[model samples]
Target: MTSASVPAAFPRAVLFDLLTALLDSWTSWNHAAGSEQAGRAWRAAYLRLTYGCGQYIAYEQLVRDAAAEVGLPESAVRSLEADWLNLTPWRGALDALRALEPHCKLAVVTNCSTRLGTQAARLFPIRWDAIVTAEEAGVYKPNARPYRLALEKLGVQANEAAFVAGSSYDMFGTAAVGLRTYWHNHVGLPLVAGAPPPEFEAPTLDSLLPWLGRFGLRPQTI
Candidate 1:
C-alpha cells in the first residue's frame, strides 16, 4: 500500500519528535565516539533502557549509561553530553520548520527530560508553540501518555494535528494515539513488525512541505 495522503484540510498544528527528526544526535555520537559501531551501541543501550525498560531517566543519564555499556571513557561521555546541549539540526529541518511556522502551530513532543529538552529548544532557530517532554509524563514513548499529554497541552485533538517522527517505533506510538503520523525515514529502514505505519514517509524533512502543499497546506511565503 502507498503512504497515506495528507487530508484535504490542514491540521491545526504539527507535533515533532525531537531527537532524530530535528537534531542529529547520531552524527554527534559518531563524532564523539570515533566510530559508527560505538555510536550505534550507545543508541541501542539508550533504546533498551528507555523503551525496553520503561525508564524516564534524564537524557544525560542515558548518555552516561550508554557510554558505560559501550566501555567509552569518562572524557568521551562528558563530551557527548556536552554535544547534546548544542545539537546540530539535521539538514533541512530548520528550513522546513521556518516555512511551516506561519501556517500552523509547531511544537516538540519529545522523549527527553525537561532540562535537556529546554536546552535543545534554545538551539532551534524557530520558537515552538509548546514543548512536551517525557519527563512531565513520567513515561517514554509508545506508552500513550506522552502523546496524550502533548495533545492536551496543544489544545488539539489527536486527529487535528500530525505527529512527525524519524523512527518506526515512534511512528507506531504516535499512530496508536490517533495522530496522523509522518516518518522521516532517511535511512530507508523498514517498519517494525506489528507496528502501525506512518501516514506519510519522506527521505528528509524538506520533502514533506511539498506533500503538505498538495493537500492545500503549503507554507506561507514571506
Candidate 2:
C-alpha cells in the first residue's frame, strides 16, 4: 500500500517522551561508561541491582545499570546527566516542531524525576505548551499512568493525543493504553523481537511531517 493510505491522524497534543526523542542519550551513556575502566566495580553492581534479570529489559533499566557501573546510586544518576553535546539533536526534530507548532498543541511526557524532567526541557531548548514528568504522577513509562497524566494535563482524551517514544516496550505500553504511538527510531535500531510495531515508525523525524499533515497540519512548503 502507498504511504498516503496508512492511518495517520495528527494528535491534538504530541506527547513526547523526553530522553531519546529530542535529546540524543545513547552517546552520552556510552561516554559516561567509558570514562571509567569497564565501569570498574560498577559493572557487577549494575548487573546485580537492577530488578529485571532477563535478557531483554526496559530502557530505564539501562540507566540504572549505567549508574551502578559508575559507582553511583540511581538517585545520584537522576541528578547527573550527560552534557548536551553528548546528545546530538534529533535529525529534523527542530524543523518538524517548528512546522507542527503552528497547527497542533505540543507537550513533553517524560519518565523521570521532576528535577530531571525539567532539566531535560531546559536542555531541549524548545517552548512547550506544558511538560509533565513521572515524578508528578508517581509512575513511569511502560506503565499507563505517565501517559495518562500527560493527557490529563493537556485536558485532552487519550485518543486525542499521540505518544512518541524511542523504545518498543514504551511504544507498546502507550498504544495499549489508548493513544496512537509514534516510534522514533532515530538510531535505526532494530524493532524489539516480540513487541508489536507502533502506528508510526521511521528512521528520522523528517518522516513525521507527512503523518502530521493528515492531522490538518502539513510541513511548510518553504
TM per candidate comes to 0.86, 0.73
Candidate 1, 1-222: lDDT as tens digits: 113564334567888888878888878887788788887787777766777646577766777887888898778777777777768888988888887787778888887889888788778878888888889888788778888888888798886788888777786578678887779877676777778877788778765665554433444221
Query: Which candidate comes out best when scored by lDDT?
Result: 1
Residue pairs with clashing backbones, model 2 = 42-69
Candidate 1: which pairs clash? Answer: none
On a 0 to 1 TM-score scale, where does candidate 1 land against the true structure? Answer: 0.86
Report the C-alpha lDDT of model 2 over 1-222, residue by residue, as the tens digit. Answer: 115555545668887877777777655654555543434344335423421332224435656766766666565444335353345667777777777686667888776556666776776556788788756765556667777777777888876667777666676567667877778877676665666788778767766766655643353221
Query: For model 2, where is the 10-residue window of minimal lDDT?
Result: 47-56
- In every candidate, how many clashes are there? 0, 1
For candidate 1, which ten residues in a row score worst on lDDT? 213-222
> Any idea how many clashes model 2 has?
1
